[model samples]
Target: MEKLQLQLFLNIIGIGSASGLLFKENSLFLISDNSTYLYEYQIEKASLEKHALVENPAENILKKDKLDFESIALKGNNVIILGSGSTKKRNQRISYDLKTKKIENKDFSVVYERFKKEASLSDDELNIEGLIITADKSYFFQRGNAGNSANGIFILNADDSLVFKKIILPKINDVEATFTDAILVDTTIYFLAAVENTASTYLDGEILGSFLGRIKVENFELENTILISKINKFEGITLFKESDKEIEFLLCEDNDTEELKSEIYKLTINQ
Candidate 1:
């Protein structure tokens, strides 16, 4: 397959590192690392304009919080922020009111604690990166790179209760090709995998590549995995629906450089 050229979107400097994107009502919401703020961007006259939706106070939240801020999903008027920490470990699925901007702590904290305990995850293994919410279910995928544990994908019921469901692991040639980010389109699940070249154990090795794969919802089985691009450190992937025929996917890299760089790729998937 031919490589699709990605367009440069808003490169907001000093935004830490962005990890996820959500498109709602013609606006894009972003979540980033160590940020107490949620960003919203709207497209006006073919240009992207940004605004701060909410600025979380550090005193109210936990300290030593990594705030991976991996993905965002909407349920009714509530926006769910999924992330994890390193030391003083916590994997939170925080819910915030979109209109009121009120943070719901009680139920959200309970659900988050339950998931953390049920997953039996340690601080090093708790890299909660992607989330997807459906009409009756909430799905979360974690990358387990620090240990020999395989990456996990979890499902929660409509009432925010845990449901035990097993996801079929991909049989990629490389073991590090674990799931990173995900999106659900109709009945298909599209996921991103960041594969690294572990052959050389000396210097800092190059990022092998990234791939986009899809699995049918009806079967919930792994299907074809295609090489999307061979970029440097691809971290997040989100799908934006333009119309019935055209769809655009945004991919981001978590580079801690002076300029916060990311690329938006528009593609027309053959249905």
Candidate 2:
């Protein structure tokens, strides 16, 4: 496989970790950590720029004093944000509508609750990190860290029903694999996974490195997993298509030196 070079786009500090990204109707939305605010960017002249910032209305309804926004998914004008706490309890999923700016808690809690019961596991074990809505309105989620296994993926039907479950095991390697972000383009699924030492005594076995992977949707099998760049800390992954024969990837890195001062890189695939 040929290694692709990553191009830097924009670096904003203290903006928060970009957990999720979506492009719809010519608008781009990025979800972060500190606040449930969706940063909007416009695609103009083959580039992106700040368009607006909208607060997630569902946050206002949360009775809990503190909440950490983990992942987000967009449906029509509604946005779903999932989060977990330090207590290791069941995570919370909140929904906010962009049209009315209304908040709805427990929008799809019943589905998740049923899945939890069927799996016979507590909420903490789910560790949902990435969420994606299909063309038919079905929901798919990726598990975060702290799970018993490295593979974590689930599906929620259009009726808000739990349909399938599968653990996406990583390719055998010396490093540990943890999925970070995912995006679906046409029939292809592209995801980012961070590979690191599973036994880091200094950082308590936390992931310290990352790689980008691509797979076809037909079989849901990994095609190629490549180490794109040596980043300080990687958070989110987004795809940009240049043309039929050309494509690029945008990866976000979280570095402490600059709060939101993250790095965005453009990458190409070897055909």
- List pairs with backbone clashes in candidate 1: none
**Residue-wise C-alpha lDDT for candidate 2, range 77-162, written one tens digit per residue:** 78766663222322466676767767675534565566556555455544455666676645344443454433455665566556
TM-score of 1: 0.76
Model 1 alpha-carbon drift over 4 Å, by segment: 1-10, 45-65, 85-89, 106-123, 159-175, 196-206, 242-246, 258-262
Clashes of each: 0, 7
| Model 1, total clashes | 0
Model 1: lDDT of residue 252: 65
Q: Tens digit of lDDT per residue, candidate 1, span 1-271?
A: 1334455555544344566767777666766654545666664533443433335433113335444466677878987877653333344556777798777542244455565577776445555567888888888776655453356676787776785344544433554665668888878888777665542211123566677777776666778676665654556676765455456677666553434444444443544
TM-score, every prediction: 0.76, 0.73
Top-scoring candidate (TM-score): 1
The 10-residue segment with the lowest total lDDT in model 2: 52-61
RMSD of each: 4.8, 5.1
